[model samples]
Target: MDPCNRFRMFLVPFVMGIAFIFADVSQALALRCTALSGDDRYSILYTVQAMHQAKIQRQGALITVFEIGGGDPALNGALLYIRIEHNDQAFVWKTGLNVHSIQQLSTGPENTLDIRAKEDFLDSNNMVISREVSYKIHFYLNNDTLEDAIFVENSPKIN
Candidate 1:
């Protein structure tokens, strides 16, 4: 084989490999998320109860219900923030009710919640990458608070 032809053959594959790597990186660059749900434990005064229906929706919402009698009634009526973490990215949404006010928090059979992303974080082309992502949820007592309050739940990656 000619030397120039051999060099061309090697160069083509090398360039193709580089292109493939770039494509993978671009896919990773888009924010991807998986569906997640699990139980959250709440305690008031020495009594602890599990909030079993907690869920984080891929579209941008966290839904969970807190029963009235487990803790202080004031705790149920306070405003809260829901924080979601995916890889190094974080998104926050405000929930109108405190920990105890939700009666039936439903994410449906798929367990997906619908949440509105902030205007700054909107990406029209990136779709939620189901099952290929992992996420964590944190609850805050105040909307302006940066730190998670007493409740944090880590969910299993849904297949």
Candidate 2:
């Protein structure tokens, strides 16, 4: 091959590789996350709870929620930040507006997420004063994202 042809061949593949790299980066950057406004409501202690993917059987391929700063298993006022992965994209929703001691995490009806927990009634100082009620909150998972959560029980609003 002539010198010009050899140089052209090398340049073409290099340019193609660079383009491929940029495409992959853009795809990763396409993760759409909801507003994490009140994420600082909880303490810094976060515990990772990884669930079995086959059990849920939803649009999310992997689901993980980090438990934030609650020690007592009985009346702990813990918060959660959920992360869902689907189709190589990730979505996060901060479940931190209320005080909950997560008792169970499982699949709910209609392919939703079932988070069974005891609601902690906190005093003005963010201390758990009472654990009077339990709640079952359902998080709807769509094709590429998790929808707004719905809950039945009324808990003290965290500011």
Candidate 3:
């Protein structure tokens, strides 16, 4: 066969193989979080206690926070998220929230008085990076209703 034909065959298969590989990797990273609610602190704290039971849950760096201020105004519910760790350092993707669930989050040593998601800790990210991951909205109680909607979102990529 001509050199042109040989190049076409090799390139086509190589490109297709790469596409397939990426598709599979993305699918594997997909995850889901179940929603739970409670009027008092015990119920809310119980949910977190159950989530952190595993030994090597995400298997990278562990990023955790307990916020006690008004939940960020942009978002309504509380949240927990996981992200891909970068170079064995802080996480790269979602930070502490690459994958997380939220709704009026309350936390306290998994035993002390529960703290709301709006608490200063949860509403903001640590100051290690030049650009900060900001919480658009956070509030302990919604003016309209206590009911909150769980949202699915993708994390921003950093190069």
Best by TM-score: 2
* RMSD (Å) of each candidate, 1 decimal: 18.7, 19.5, 17.4
Tell me which of candidates 2 and 3 scores higher on lDDT: 2
Model 1: pairs clashing at backbone N, Cα or C within 3 Å: 57-113, 60-115, 76-100
TM-scores, all models, native as reference = 0.24, 0.44, 0.22
Rank all candidate structures by their lDDT, best first, as comma-separated numbers. Answer: 2, 1, 3
Candidate 1 global CA lDDT score: 0.35
Q: Show how many residue pairs clash in every candidate, following the order shown.
A: 3, 0, 25
lDDT of each candidate versus the true structure: 0.35, 0.48, 0.30
As a TM-score, model 1 comes out at 0.24
- Pairwise TM-score winner, candidates 1 and 3: 1
Give the Cα error of residue 119 in candidate 3, in Å: 41
The digit string of per-residue lDDT tens for model 2 on 1-159 reads 999999999999789667645632432231333534345423333454322232456454565656665544544435556655556655456654333445565655654445555554434454556543333334455655655443332322222
Compute the lDDT for candidate 2.
0.48
